[model samples]
Structures are given as structure tokens and as C-alpha cells.
Target chain A: MSGRTDTINELVRTPPTSFVDSLARARVRDRLVDGVAASVGDLPSGALVEVTLASIRRARSHPEALGQSEEPFAWKPVFVRRSLGLAAVRSCAEGRFALPSAAVGPVADQAVEEWERTGQRTFHWEPWFAGLGVGGRAVVLAEAAAWATSLWAAFDWTTLNSQVRIGGMDDLWTCPAPRTVRLKGRSEVRTRLDMVVDGRRIAGSDGGPSALVSVSGGVPSEGWREDLAYLALVAGLRAPDRPVPARVVGLWPDAAEERTVEIDEAALDGAVDRVVATVAMTAAAARSTSDDRPGCTSDSGTLVGSAAA
Target chain B: MAGPVAGPVAGPVAGHVAGPGTSGSTPWSASWQPLAGAALLERLRVTGRPRPAADPVLSSDLRSFLESGLCEVLVEAAGSGLVVTQGRLTRALTCRAHRMDDQSAEHEFTIPLATSALIDVLFRQLVTTGSIDDPMADALDGLSLDAHRAPLVDWMHGLAQAERRELRSEVERQADGLRQRWPALDPSWLPRTQTPLRAVLAGGQIDLSVYVDLVIGRPAADVASVAFVDVRSGARRPGHRDDRHLGALVEALRAPAPPFAVATYYTKTGELDVDPVDSDLLVAAARRCLAGIRAMDSLGRGEEPEGTGSESCTMCAMGLSGEPTPATASIGAISNVAEAILHVAEARVVAPSTQTYAQGQAA
Candidate 1:
């Protein structure tokens, strides 16, 4: 089989151990931080930019499309399946083997309770979920259950390292740029190698070089390498003091397939280019809107306004 | 060689029950997959859950026996061979002449008169998210999202207002029935909808394919844990009992063991007929399968298919006429083209049909 196929087979069949990058951790983070700073230098002050793998890909492929106004995000069955599925996975990762069908409703209720306690109606999911009729709620449960089953079936949970991180807020990286910019890399599965000291492998509880594992839909695209590398970059940026992830593993469960991208200098640079291109496109889109209507706070009103708000 | 005609097949097995009153006191082990959702099925509940007598060793032996027998049948058949689906098996057993007609006919995309497919789509949505606002609108939107259903969706949109109203009412009635019967299934049951099973034989030339509407519970328990539920939007048919049987056989071939129970939930009448799976059911289903494959092979060889003078003969494409002939029905109908056509036309006029022939096809 080809090397690419071999990498995916190894990834699916065995616990990941061989793909660890040999690059120095500190040097790589410095290079990535510098790249981020240079990329967003031209954006206006107090502009909030959130770069996700989706955003970077869209920026590369459909830059002009970004400038056009977007419809506000709605709560579709397809949209929240992953979010609710991840909650079930969190429970599973913590040794509670509950199916998505059983866990999603309770977790959603918990989220609404939390939202109610804080009196935060900033996001409409809690209210929308709370207000749905029995059938509508059941539809949400069905969609999420299917999503969770896919994730659950993809990995043999018993075989993974006990410290595997499922999903949470820790994956977000707030880039230390002049403007308010954040790169979010919400991975489905995260595993760290045992920390080694003096050439002997040490089973440290934490603080070891890790790998980011994510699940994507359908097949891998041409920008898959950059997409995974962007996640690795965000993970590194999120914890600069710790070691950078050696690699990023992407699994497409629908096809029973996977792709691995080693997070070396080239992959990180590609990710940086995509992020820079994304910001540039957003700025151009904002400027074009401003030119069309002759200025009414277009800088803040464009991409940043909707994202930040 | 004489082909096994439809009427000679054995009568319905004794294991199935039409409605509720099943014992529900089975204590579940820790590793056992839970069927908390099945427990709520008041109408479809079976008497004391039937545990599989076959252990893993016995299950493996049964699979090998079925596979070898099925493989032998396929090896004896001619040409590149056929993919045996659940629909084909049901048809082949109920009426061989009709099955042959379907096999010989060319497929055409026509506007559906029946609302079962729409009801099915809506029912699936209900399964996923236990609520629906407008059945007609949700079904349309759901159909629109599917690339394959674009043509059907467009056709529905172009339908006359009267037809649309009729269709919506039919769908709404069924949707109500579905909601009334189907309980809020516990997520712990790990209810999976539209689960497909395929078992290949004769080097992938012959595929036994079945798409179960809903499969509850996981396999790998001490007792049989998985339960298969088939949703039906129309009135229940005698042949419908074979659905879960066929599903169980195919699942047994693939999984470590067969599912514990199989149910058919009729959405039009709110009737749920359930049966427990056992070695006898699987063996009987296998015998029927072999007979169907033999009939299919006979058709493949260009031999004329025999007609059974049963009640469904009125709707039969063969248009066979005359009284029920238990002994000679296979050769009873020798109608010429014009007579056959006239008989079919008269049957259509005489039959007080609630649904159009096309609508029945959708079901």
C-alpha cells in the first residue's frame, strides 16, 4: 500500500506513537507566533477575528464569498449533533459509557440550566432547545445519537491512553495580536505521549508532547493537511509553555478513512498562510462593503461584528 | 425441474403475538445491552423475553450451516446471478407470478399517490427528534434535502391543490397514528434507525440485503439483546411477518447472534405485531429463502412463473382470473393479452380502493 494509506491504517489500528515530530518545541512556537502577528498586522484596532479550520478553508477556496453578508446561524438538527455528541463523548471519556441518545437530552438540559442560572441569553441554543416540542426535541436527539454513534464506533475507547482529552474550551487559542483574534481547534480526541526523562520513558501524569485527533465529514480535501496543521498550531499556541503536538490526525468516519499530517515547519507555514489569507479576505470584504455604502462603521460591522457579538 | 410455487410455503409460525401482555421481569446484567425503549412498547410487547439458547459456538455453527446451504443454491443458479433483497423474498413467497412481473417490468419514475414514503420520511424525523410541527412541510423539507428525492419533491410541489390536500390528510392521519404508538425511546437503548444489513454469497454475486427501520440495543450480551422494529404506514399484510424474520436471518449471518425480538408497527392502524426470534424461526426463514431463490433462478432461466389464485390476485400484474385452484392454480390462468388487460381494468373499477395502485407501491 501507499505511504498515505499506511499512515491511516496505523492510525486506525494502533495507538499513535511513531509520528511524533523531532522539531524543537520552543523554536516552533516562536515561529508560529511570529507568523500570526505578521498575518493580522493590517486589520483595524479592536477587531475580533476568530479563525477556525472551516474559516481558513473558505478563505483559501472562496475568498470573495466571505465578503457577502451571511445569514445568522440557526439551530438545525445537523448543526448541534456534533456539540451534543461531544458532550456524550465527554461522559464516555470519563468512564461513563452512555449512548448519545440517552445522554444528549440530559446534557442539553444541563446546559440550559447553567444558562438559566447565569441569566445569559447571549446564545439562543438553550432557549431554542428548551422551547422545542417533544417531536422536535426527539429529532435533535436522533441526529445527535447518530453523530455520537459514529464517533463511538470509530475508536475503540478501551485501547486509548487514560489521559485522552475528548472535547472542551481548552483547545481555543487567543492569538496575542493587536486585535482580538482567536483560533479555535475543538478536537474530538486528544492524546499525549508519555513524558520521557534522560532517555527513559517516564509515565508522567501530564505535560507531554501531544497529538490532536479530529473527525471530519466525507473525504479529505486538498487543504486537509493545512486544516489539521491549523488545529495543531492553535493547540501549540493555546499552551506555548508546553510542547507542540507532533502530528494532527483527521478521521472521516463515513468512509472509514483517516489522514495524518506531521506538524513540521512546512505544514505550520501552510496553516499560517491560510490564516493570513483569511484575515486579508475579511478585510477586503469589509472595505468593499464600506466602499459600496460609503462607510457606517463597516470595519466593526462586517465579519468581526457578527463573530464577536 | 419443478419450481417451488408460492402457495406450498408453510403457514405462519406459532411464536408471534398480535398485541401486548408480555412478562417484563428479566433482570439485566451489567454488560447486557439495555432495551429500556422496548419495555415501553405496550402494544408490541412480547410475553417473557425469549433468550437465545444458542451460545456463540452454536450461533457460529448456525451461520456456517445457512451460508453453506445458501451458497449451494447460488452455485446451482445460472448467469452472473441476482441480489436477493427482503422485498424480493416477501414478493416471491406471497405471489411468484407478481414477483416475476415486477422482475420483468422496467422501472419508471412516477408521481406517487400513496403517502407512505412521505409518512416514512416524517416518521424518521420523529424518530430522530421526537417532535414535528407540520407533517407535510417537514416531510417536504426533508425530501428536498435528499439529492435523490429532488425529482419527487419537485413533483410534490407541482401537484394540484386537491391532490396535495388529499396527500397531506393521508400523511397527517398516519403521522398521528405513529406518534400515538411510538413512545419516547430511551437513549440507553441505543436506538438506531435505518440500519442496513448485507450478507454476500457466491463471491459477492448474490447479496442478501435488508434495511431495518429501527434496531434497538447492542449485541454481545449473555442473552439476546438487540431488537429489530419495522415501521409500516399501511394496513398489516400476512407477508409482513416475514420482514423481521428475514432481517433476523441476515443479522445473524453478520453479527455474533440474532436479535431477540422483531416487531412490525403499523402506523395507519396503531397496531404493533411482535415475535421472538428462535432457531425454528431462522431455519424456517432460511427454507423460505431457498425456495424463493429457486423460483428466482427459474425466472432467470426464462421459465414461466406460476400464479397463485389468492386474494391479492386482483391486484396482481399477471391479471389471472377465475376461482382459487389449490392444486392447479399454477397453470389455471392462461389468459390472452386482451383478456388479461380487460380483467385488470375491471378489477380496478370494481375494487373500492382507498389508495391508488401507485400509492400501494409506495407502501
Candidate 2:
């Protein structure tokens, strides 16, 4: 009475149902699964090695390298030199060096005692005698002097506070160094800069109404203020209200005040029009380069005197 | 779904239902009338409702089950009484002893997974010991307590733990034997939650804190009331035991804070309180916690197991718990499991300059 007989014969097919399609389809599906699993098993060894190497690199092997190194000078400028024979310039302006640490009373305590005797707010000196194990203090002292020259290119008299010695200490050997000084055994480097300030507008030594804005960039590219918009505003040659297509850096010294926005040379016709539309400008002037050698790589400029002041 | 013949319909009236004379109904025709209508109604009835366990099983032979798949009479039986219920799947703890979270727990705390093998192997240990727990700690505790049986104890213990996770050891053992036989068979299982540090730092995953808010259930209240009245005390009000204290706990459980992890800091001596979270909030918290773990993974990122030179590393399980030493961030110390073992790694984050670092303290 039931219709199970035909359906049962159809349901329990082994090799072929009607010998044409079902057998062929079953073979295709089984083959596909085998192929997928087999391919999954064959992952390459090169990819494994890449992952292993990457993990190792991420852990970091080196102890001394801080952040990233950028361009020609890989390290931060620890010392700035103006003329020569000055104290060192240090990039770490806010921190104090720890004492050699083996000392019984700790270096800070001993330095505080020395500061009490000296009666000054700041102190600048290195060890005269290499009585301690620090025999190579001279190497540190020399670098500090080089830094002093560069930093003091803008300032003549760097302060010396005896009381706030290197991290609250005053002993030449045991003490901390002053926050803003490069010291070599009580000697300080002083370099003079000539600045002309009329009310607020600062002029250069050559009687030009220009302010030296020193822009120091650090390695791995981050310490140079990342905001290009802010930088364009300060550079004054270009106002960044829109995308101007090309990046520009303007450097001028002892030149007439740029009354007009200067354009770069060899521009296609639409380039000047784009600059006028994008950058804050008076009438556009013919593009000129700043000095080629010592001061700048730009040729003939009455358009820029940028910072590094 | 084979159909009627594709040839022309040149016979009776095209719209009429089937009748006896034109098709020449056999003697079984009258019987099939009610049966056919009944079959149609039966299919319609069974659409949403289950088949009432009247669905045939081993009792049905090929002739009996016209639609059910069977060649010879089926052997396996699933009778009408085979209905499984929710209570069978779920379990609850008989011992209501609360677990001690790290901060509130006693210093130098020791936990003995109490009772005979019945309790230790079968019950509390089920909740406490697993790959989810510290395997090394579990192994050490097992060895110390039942080291005499040695190989036998370990075998039994492994079996019990495997059963706890509802995985049969025989399956793994069979796989192991197969792998041994087939030298090229490489079987590796990775945790679902753990992605590499690069992926986490690059925001490869959708940020956990954002989507985790879609936890199961309605949103909870923000303000929490923590009442400290004990009805058991003579001086305390009895009504507070049920009304206020539990009321607060139930509310807190349902509606935890926005920042899922909040330290309940006591003002007097800088102590902390861990509040109970609602079931839904807990689930949401669990997923969001993965992000914090992802963050920790990035900060320590490819961190070496060696001393971070911080005093906090003292409590690090990845570091030797008893003694601090330089070592490879020993074999997957940065894994999610390691983060759980070193719960303090998530709990306490102290930020100080190199000078004020706790490790810099006088030895």
C-alpha cells in the first residue's frame, strides 16, 4: 500500500542512478574536498620564516637605539655648536643623570652637600679628578661642549645654578649636571648672538626685519612638528587653506620683506593660478632661490627667512 | 521535484480537481480521498510545530517510513521519550563558596582543590583546572598531592579534565596514534581570540569596546548604590538584608559601568572592591576585556620575558613566581592565558619616571 519501494531503490544508489549524472556529481564533490584539504596542508616554509623573523625584530635586540634614526644625522643633536670651544648641547633637557650608583650615600646626597657650601641656585661642572671608576669622563665632557656651542649659537650666557646641581646634587664627581648647560669641570661655554628687537618684531644682525625661527627636527621623522598646516602658517610665504600640490620650504636672510607671495620657477601655466588660489598671497612675485652655500641651498630669495633660529 | 509530462493537456476540463470516472478510480480511490486530505493537513500542521516525537525511528522499516531515509529496516532508535530538556544540559554548584579575587584574597594564598577524587576530580576541579586555568599550576598541584600513583594518577587526571571540557581523551589519543603513524600529519589548533600584536596594534579587528555594547538584553542603569548594611548583625536593620544590599547587587549585576572595568577603590587605605556584574553585562564585559588584553599585548607587544626592570614584574606569572630572573618571555607568556594567570598585569598599572620606578628602589 505504501510507495516506499521505488523511492528506496532511488535513495540507495551506489555507483550510478540512471548511470549518467549522479555518479559524476558525487565524484566531483569528493575530489573538491580532497583538493581543498590538501592545498591547506601545503602552506609554504618561507611564510613561516618571515613571521618568525618579524616577531624577533619586534622584540628589539638593541639596547641603545631610542625611537628611529632619520636622514644624515641619525642621532638627536646632543650638542649644538655656534663658533667653537663651548660647553655641550644636550637633547635631554628635562632629565638629570643618576650618580655612578656605587657610591654609599648616593650621588644626590653628596651633591646636595656641595650645593649647600656653594650658595648658588645652579651649578655647572664635571669631575676634575678621575678618582672614581669613571676614567672616561672626558669623552662625555667633550660631547657636552660640542652641544653647548650649537645651543649657545643663539644665547651668550647660559645660567649656572650651584644649588640645583645635577638632579639636586653639587659634587663635581657625584652631582647632577645643570638642566641647560654643558659643563667641563666648572667651566661654562658662553656664545654671543646679535638680535635686534623693535617692540616685538625681531630683526637680524644685517638690519633686516626678520625673526629667526629655529625648527629642530628629530629622527624617525616625528619631532619635527607633524602638522604641516601650522608650519605653513608660520612660514608666511604660503598660507595653507587648500591643497597646493607641492611642498615648499622658504628660507631668506638679509632680504627685502616679501610683500608678495613668491612662486617657484619653471611652473606650468596653471601652477601659479593654483598657488594664488591655495596659498595666502599678495600679488605673486617671480620665484627666486635663497643663498646656495653656507646659509641655504635655495638660490636668490627675498621671500623667506625660516626658523632654525 | 519532477513534474507532469510537458506535453499538451488535451483531456478533461483544465481547472477541475481529479474525479473517479475520467481517471477511472480503482476500488482504493474512496479510501485515498480522506487520506490525501489528511496528509495535506498533516504537513501544514507540522510546519512550525515539532513532529511530537511521533517521527519514526528504529521501529520503522523501509515499508513503514515512506519518506524517512532507510534501505533495510533502520537499527538505531530514538524513541518519543527521547526529548532532552534544558535542565539536563545545565549544572549549578552545590558549594556556594565565593572565589577570592587577587586583591581581596589573602597574601601568599594557597588553594587546595578540596575533597576526595570525587570532589577534586569530579566537581570543584572541573571549574578550577583546565588549559583555561594555569596548566603548570594544575600539574604542579596534581604532582604534589598525588605523586605516588605517578603515571596512573596523571592518566586519570588527564581523562577527568578532558571529560570536564566534554572532550573525550580517546579522540585525542586516536589522533595522536594516527599522527605517529603518519609522520607528515601536522595538527595545530590556535586560540580564536588571540591575533598577533601587529594585527592588534594596526586595528585589524573591529575595536572591541564599540561593538561589545550589543550584549544580550536591555541597557542597564549607570548609578550604583553600594549599601554596607549587614542584617545578620544585632545593630543592623533586618529589612536591608533583602531590600537594599541584594537590591544593589542585582542592579549592579544587570547594569555595570560604561568603562566595564572599574576599580572600586576604598578611600581610607587604598583598598579595592570588585562588584558583581549582571549576566548580560558580564558577557559584554568578557568581550570588551579582549580589547584591554589586545592593548596589553601591544604595549608589551613582542615583550621579552626578561625583567621589564619594574617591581610589578615580581607578581608576573610569566616571570618565575618565586624568583625574578632574566628569561625568554618563556614560550607564549604574552598569550591570553598568561594574561589571566597574571591578573595583576591587568589590574595594576603604575606610571612613573625611570627615576621613580619601583625597581629603582633600594635593594
Candidate 3:
């Protein structure tokens, strides 16, 4: 626990101010975007996390496995519960309402209802919800409500502007590049920082500094700061116009604790390096599989290698 | 928070069903009727016409099963990207000439994006309070005033004095109309605006997603108690009734039993058209959705699905010849469509960023 805490503390330390900071940040963002674009070239669009996890798994087990089909990711009740809990907390935060455990059920119900209404089968949680008995569903909803209550209690909702606090699954940041390379950034809560400009309190524009708040579970894990940095990087790349996120705050409800990662040149560079490596690995894995296919063409190999280069 | 209260009264109204489906019973049925799963399969058989022989293989086993009634040969195509939305489904069903083309245009999205953001803000406010005092001001305040919405806001602010005056007056009128017509919804109803609805069909091989404008009622309520509301700005167009029915179908499929009803409200005309959720509505809506999925599957297979020439073709940008000039074009519609298009584009741009950022660090 002490070692993990130190790692988390070191990751959250204040960043240095330097003249080349902006340039460094820009370079990192561009490299990350280009790397992601290269690896994701014309591949099926998926969340960054999904692609990374899949790539890592593929790399470890049978990296040469040919003709493998992507397996459907099954979403469990815990995912839905977490998502619903976040939504409940967000609604309360943005609407300036008191947190209530009862509010969680409706939010969960609405999520299910929305999933059904939209016919988006990609949600993956529908089957889980459908499989639950009435009592089982109630328990899930209760747990979600409790989770939301804990989160709401942990934050000072009034300090944040109710109107500006973007929450839920809505604020997904996406960067689509040539050859169908697509990357997405998902945050549970994002809000613009108010800057004092010329003696006037003005809300930052999308291009201006902003804070990203993510809700997670358990103790701070390895690469947690890099994750936040990557989110900031992707968010910046997607907008290009918007300023890189000022800071990212990770909230762990179970522990009733939080870790803040300030976005800086070093953070951006770290994120870029990690993403480039992941994308290269994914591209290599994809290439290996494609090479073993029945009608494999040399052209496909060239494309993958050149893109990853 | 308060415990669940008694459900709202269900009743029927007289009007053409808005998006798709047959007109029959009242808006709210006295009893809940579940949409049988088999009924959807039957509807697909009736609606999903076969495409050309040269069409590519329908990729997923689930899709092929839905189309050909054969569950075998579910080949999961490696890395296929397919996103089916309500608008795309509506277009697939209503348009005669369908060609999949990139319709990305910078200018095409200006008006609609602004309108949607404005409307979304007002609705969000409405969910908090039963009524809106000043729609324009309230909406402006609610906007994050970010880069994406800045142009829309600027355009809004750049209006001529007279135009601004007219806009404000219109906003006030619409807001008042919405307030008067809107039922005294309990805060406990947990009304949400711009709620996303997604589901996996055919064993997670096909994904369908859409966003409902406003939804009220608890999921824990009786299956027949939840209600879905769609807000529109213009006079209802042809096949618009089917859209509402689609909303009903979505709710019915997701609910413990079936939803109570679904309604479409026209802010411009102050018209509210309601349709009871029934097996018939679900079947009809499912047919359209299935037909859409089939069309999408065909498109995915490098085959052009036949389009049923209709009013939707006017808005189709697939470069089909001899298309009629859009008859339903209006300032409101233009803005709405623009906003919807840009909203979709923005989401695409943002989704990947968020996912990557969070996932990258987690890794």
C-alpha cells in the first residue's frame, strides 16, 4: 500500500514550468494521434480500452493465431451498476439536487429503457439486465444507488456549475484520422474551469483549460496517471482547438479517496509513448493474423508495416 | 428521495401515428400487451425484401438469421464498423434511392447543431423545473459555451435586432406552449433529456443506438407505465409517425413487459401525437428496424439495397438522379437537421478520444 501510494503521489506531483512545454505537449499529442491512426487504419471502430485489451491479450496468447474472430465483449451487472451510479450522481450534480438511494433505480431503469429504445445492441448490458429476476434487478439498482450516493457525498457539487458539468456517457471525445483510425475518450464528468480574465470571471471555452473527473473503483493502480494523461491527450487531439486538459481527477468511491493528475509536457509525452507502443503492438498483431489468412496478399503486409513504421 | 408514486393516467388521442406503424387503438392502452419476440421475426419476414444476387455475404450469423431465418454460418467479420441509428433506419425505410456516401460537410451542420443544443438545454431545464421562464436565456446559460457550440452561439448572437426579437418571441411562444401542454410530471419521475438507448441484436453481432429526446417514468414501474417523448420543431412529416412507433418498439423490447405508450410533440405547432405501445406497434416498428438492419447488412456486403422512393429521397445525398427538390424544407427543419448531423459528427470525434484517454491510462 505504501509503495502504491508513493507511486500515485509521484505521478500527481506538480509539473515543471518550462519554455518548451507547449511545444513538447504538441509533439506528444501529434505522435499519439498519428500512432493511433496508423494502427487503427481501416479496422473496426472500438473503444481505445477495448482495442488495447484485445491487443494485449492477443499478444500474450497465440500471437500467431490465424483467422480468429473478435469475440463479443459481455458487459456484467457491475458495469451497468457503475454506469448507472455515475449517471445518478451526475444528474444530481448538474441539477443541484440532493443525492438519494432511490434515485439510482430510475437511472438504471432509464439506461435500460434507452438501450432498448435505441436498438443499440453494442451496449452489451442488455442481456445481463434481461437475465436478472425482479429481486435480483432490485439489488443491482440498490447497489447502484448506494454507489451514486457515495460519489455525490464525496464531491462538493455546489462549487461546480450545474449547467456546465457534462456527465454520463455523453462526453465521449473521438479523433478520426485517415485510413479509418479512430480513437475515443470517455469521461464520466467533465467541466470547464472558470478563469479570471481581465478582472472578469469567465467560463473557459472548449479550447480553454478544463478539468476531467473520472470515477473508478479500488486503490490507485499502476499506469493510472498515464491513463489520465492519455485521456487529456486524446481529448486535446480530438478538438485540436481545445486546450489540453488542465487536470484529471480520479475518484475511487469504495475507498472514498481521489488522485489528481495535472496535465503537463511530461504527462503528455508519457501518454504518447505508451499509446505509440500499444498501437504498434496492435498493428503488429493484426498484421500477423492477416499474413496467415488464406488469400493473404503481400500488399496487406506492406500496408501494415508502413503504417506502423 | 420519495418512494414510487401511483402511475400516470393512460389514455388515447386521435391523430395519425407519427413515425411508422398502423393507427388503431388510443394513445394509452388500458392494459399492457407484450410484444412477442416471434412477432418481430414475422414482421422482418414481411418487410425485409431480398436484395440483388451480386450482394456481398451478410457478415454476421445473427444478421443472416434475422434475414434468411437460418441461424448457422455466423461469421464474425474481423474489425467491421457498423453503427445503426434511428435516423439511418428511418432513411433506409423511407428513401427510394439509398447509397452509402460520406455526407460530411462543414456548412451542412451549422443550424441544426445550434437548434439541438438550444432545445437540449431548455429540456434539461424543464426536467429540473416543470416550466421554463426564458427559453433563450436559459438555454444560453446552460450551454458550456465551448468551441463546438461557440459558432452556434455566435450565430445566435449575431442575429439582427429584429431577427433576434423574432427569435426570442418564438422561443417564448414555444416554451410557453411546452409548459402548458406538458403534464405536471413529478420530479421523482426522473425525467432525462437526450437519453441514449442502445441494444445488441443477433447475439452482439449487430449494434443499434439512438437517442430519445425526453423520457419519463421509472423502469421499476409496471412495464406499461414508462413513457417516451420525442420533441420536434416542425409539422409532422410522412413516416414521422413510424419514428414514434420505433420509440415505442424500443421501450417495449427493453421493458419488463411493454411500455405504456410513446408520444411525439411538435413545438412549432403545439401538436402532441400519442400512440399506445402494443404488439402491433412493436411488430411494425421492428419490421422497419429489421429492414434497416438488412439494408445496412447489404451495404456492408458491398451491395446497394433497393430504396423505396418516397419523401425521404429529397433529403438523401446519395447522388441519385431526378430526385425532387425537398418539399418539406423549412428553416426549422434545416437547423434541426444540421444540428443532428453535427451532433453525430461531434460524438464520433469525441467518443474515441475519451475511450482512448481513459483506456490508455488504465492499461
Candidate 4:
């Protein structure tokens, strides 16, 4: 047991954490701000917001109350100037499209969905007529929440460890003010899920990580209603320490009539695995191309074998 | 008097996981104290070897059949390495098996654990959740499974049945043709003489019995001695750089007290003579094989034992291609020296502006 613990301990300390400098953090910030600016643009006018708010609040005079947070932070932009920055992000990252692109698409797609409709411009609205009922504002709120969450998510993506923000109404739309990247690496041999369950103590209830399930109060619906639940299930159950036999099944289409234990479990396991693996592979490919890993700290650069590539 | 055969006595436990609970690998909960060395796999190989004549006819025919240009080759780019066209090999074998009249057996495309972990993770996830909306379904269509299975499964099954029936009918159809055309022939040579393998537990019961022995036997050569050449891509490279791994493999092959032998098997293009490994290779490979392993040991330096990285840098397990990209820094490139410099600079930048000016004047 001691030997095993020792082995585990070594895995913890041995790997290099980074090869790039704070410059990496700076690069990440630049890409993110650029991505956002390209997709969506500046905030909405107070008059426009006031009108939309008034229309929705007619049923209830205090318009700020409906699912809308009274908390001041909730007042920030949703589909406006923030989306342009995301658009910029999408373009810059478009070239290395495969790396963690899956993660990016959810955020961008949601923002795009908000941009195309703009709540004020939905089929339900006549820019002249009350601009997309409360539902439209709901969309804006959802989009804003999503953008904010994604910015936070970017912190996960960037090298800048300091506090960061994604979308603010004024001055810098998505500012981490680029300087340098100093990123951290993931752990080795934490492959097993008990670490998720017990060791790493990732505080998720039986339902699973709320972060995985929730974008915020809002679901990134365009990317939502998709198989994120399925993905969450997979990530939750993935056998880290060793391989496990798995099956992803649904009630077979024909089973609808006699919903009683209709035994048909199609193979979805390998498909999901491919998606996760592709993300890792793509990132490894980028680092390999730059031959830049050589400059990063050993822990952060890559797994011993991955760096070789 | 004897023990299990000198091979992976357990062949993936017939669709079982390689962890505890059932037939999978060591469970995560169970502290992984992988047996002291290759010593375990090696010792097991020796005491449990299956008996055979000293000089059995080396199945060179199997080798020639596998490597021969009798089938078409296919290749795909995999993230870890080039995915060689094993399709030709599989097809050639299937055809040969049909011609020889052995239709019931099945062969699956096998991938090493390290290379296939991503798939394993997804599969595990699928098992847990049981449903994938259009998003996952679209991503899955791009893999070898869909590509290979879609166009081939039905075609091969049809060919198998047709070939068997056609061969059988040819004999009856040409009793006259057989006599004159095949006077020197055994007469039965033209007929399909295969005993198609099939098993049935009941009308709808699950029956999974096989006649062939499918054991895992590593190549006899040391990791250093062998070369992993992509036969289709013509991408050939030595299997290992360090010789210590090779020495471990050798020790396993020639375990005198334990008694092991190099076991050989034939694949489409070549024959692999493998032996049970000794204690050394496992330890050495374990230390270095992280890079090759899928999605594991990256943060902790897959090869090194004591390393840590951040959760942000972790590649998304979900398969969303359109999701917002993580920062380049999130991919992890900051060095310790860089970190120190960054901290100092931050200190310089954050320190009182007046203090900085005074220090500059004194210097």
C-alpha cells in the first residue's frame, strides 16, 4: 500500500506543469477578447432595454423580477457587444478548430443563437412592436449568463491564473488584458473516478456536476437539448484507472408502443470516447506543430509520450 | 501438475472491463500497486504453458496468407498514430476462412489499451447514460467502426453464406465436370467442405461460446528490438528507444527457473513470436508509456510519478466541436522560471509607483 501511495505521489510531483510563460496567459486573453469582438458587438441602449423591460413587466409592474436577477450583475449585456468578441474568438480559433473546439462551440453557438435573434428581432417581435416579449428578454438573459459563464470557463483555458471577467457592459467587453500565459497542467494516474468521487472531491451531488449540466440559470439551449446529459453521464462513469465495458442505449424507437423493458441498447460508448479523445489529440497536434512545448515547464508541457509527438 | 497457459489467461474477460468489480483492470478504489514487476505475468506464463510437440510445424502459411497481396488495404489517420489498413487483412482472412469452409468464427479489430482509452471512456459514459442525441451520433459516424461496419458487415455475411452454398452446389452441379476436369483432384476438393460454426443456447437465449483460443501474447522481442512500421502508410519506426525495456522482455522470454517460451502467431502480413514478459519491462514501460496513453497522466506527467497540472487544461471529455476554445495558456505552457519572472514583474507593476522610481534612482 505504501509502495502504491509512493507511486501515486511520484506521478503527482514529477510531470512538468508548463513550458510557456505568463505570455501564454496573455495569448489566451488576446484570443478570447478577439473571439468575442468578432462575433457580437456593443451593449444595447438603456431606452431599448427600458422598453423591453416595461412591456414584459406589464403583467407584473416590477419587470426586473421575472427570472431576471435583481442583482446588479444581471443587468449586463447578453447578445450585444459581447457576442462580437466571441465571434472574434471563433475566427482566431477556427484555424485550430479541433482542439477543445467542442467546448468552444457550445459557448459560441449559444451566443450566435442570441445574436441572430437578438430577442428584439425574433419573428415574435416587430422592432416596432415591443421587441420579443419577456421570452425574448429571457433569451437575452440566458445569452448573457452563458457569455459570462464561458468567460469564466476561459479562465480554465487561459494561462492567466488571476481573477478574470468575460463580459462587462462598459470599457473592456472581455478583458483579462493580455500580457503572458502561465498555465497549469492536469494530474496523472488520477485516471480512476474514485478521485472524482472521493479523492479530488469534485463536489457534485448524485445528479452530477451542476457546472456540466447548467450554463447558469440558463441552459445553452442551441447547444442544449443535445446529448450533454449523455456526455455528463459518460464523464461521470468513465473508468479512469482502467478500461471498462460500457453501453449507451436509448429506448429503441419501436419500443414506444410497449415501453415495458424494451431491450435494445445501441452502442454509444465508443462514439463518445472518440469525441473526448479527438480533443486531446487536437491539442497535442497544435503543441507538436509549434515545437513550443520544449520551452514550457515539464509538468505543463505534456505527458511524457504526448510531448514526444 | 501444470497451470494456466503462458499467455493472458484472461482474454478481456469476454467483453468484461479491465478493472476490478468484474474482469476489468485494477479498480480506481483499489490502490493500484501493479504487481511488483513483469515478474508476475512472466511467472504465470511459465507455470501455465499449454503443452505441444517440441517442433510443431511453424505456421508460415498463416504468415504468407496474411501479408500477401490478396486483399485491398485501407488506412486512416488516428490521433495517437497512423491507423493501418487492417481491413485488407481481415477481409483476406474472412475470404480464406470462407473458402476453407470455416464460416462460424469471428474476428474483431483489436486496439491496445493506451491507444484506445478515449473510446473506452466514451463507451463507459454511454454505458452509464444510455442515450446520445444527434450531437454524439454525428461525431461517432466518423470513426472506423461506422465506416468499416456499415459497408462490410452485410456484404461479408452475404458472401459467407453464398460462398458456402455455392461451393456445395458446385459439386452437385458438376459431377460430370468434376470427373474429367478433376481426375487427379480428390473430387471433394471443389466442394465446400466447411463445418460452419454456430452455437445456440435456445431460441432467444444468449450463447457466446467459441472454439478458438484467443489469448494475448506479447512479441518476444524487447520493446527496443521491435519496430512499429505502418505497413500501409510505409511509416516505420522502432518500437522503443530505451534498451532497459528490451532487457526486461528478454528476461521474461528466458525465465529459466520459471520456464517460459517464445510463442508465435501469424497475422496477415507477418508472424509475431511473442513471449510472456518478465518483471522489468512492465516497470520501465509504465514509467514512460504515459505520452502514448490516451487522456491519462497528462497533468501528472504521464511518465513521471509526481506531477500536477490544472483542471482547466484538461481536454473536454464532451465531444462538442463548436464549444468556445480554452485559452492557449489553458493548454499549459508556463514554466517555473517564467512563473517566477511573472510574479516578480507583477510585484514590480503592483508595488507603489513612487517606490519603484526611488529604487530606480538609487540603482
* Top of the candidates by DockQ: 1
Candidate 1 at residue B23, lDDT?
21
Over the stretch B1-363, how does candidate 4's per-residue lDDT look in tens digits? 111332223332222122211011222444533221232223223322131211101112111221221111101111122111112112221212131232242343212211122122122222112222221221122121323344432333344565635433432222222122211211111110000111111111211111111111211211211111111111111221122232232222221111123222111112122332222222232222211111122211323112111212111222212232332332123334433432443343221223321232232
Model 1: per-residue Cα lDDT at residue A218: 41
Q: Lowest-lDDT window of 10 residues in candidate 1 chain A?
A: A300-309
| Candidate 3 per-residue lDDT over residues B40-152, each given as its tens digit | 11221111111111101111221232333212212533234345677777655444333222233434434445555666556545544445665777666555323456667
lDDT tens readout by residue for model 2, A74-182: 2111221211122112221222321111111122234445656774422222122122112112222222232232222222112211111111111121101111110
TM-score of 2: 0.14
Task: Report the TM-score for the A-chain of model 4.
Answer: 0.20
Ordered from best to worst TM-score, the candidate numbers read: 1, 3, 4, 2
User: How many clashes in candidate 1?
Assistant: 16
Error of 4 at A249 (Å): 31
Query: Can you tell me the CAPRI class of model 1?
Result: incorrect
DockQ, every prediction: 0.09, 0.01, 0.03, 0.01
Which segments of candidate 3 are over 4 A away from where they belong? Answer: A1-309, B1-78, B94-116, B131-133, B145-151, B158-163, B253-255, B297-303, B311-363
Model 3 TM-score (2 dp): 0.43
> Model 3 interface RMSD, in angstroms?
17.6
Which of the two candidates, 1 or 3, achieves a greater lDDT against the reference?
Answer: 1
Off by over 4 Å in 2: A1-23, A26-309, B1-120, B124-280, B283-288, B299-363
Best by lDDT: 1
Model 4 regions lying over 4 Å from their true place: A1-9, A13-31, A35-309, B1-44, B47-146, B160-363
What is the descending lDDT order? 1, 3, 4, 2
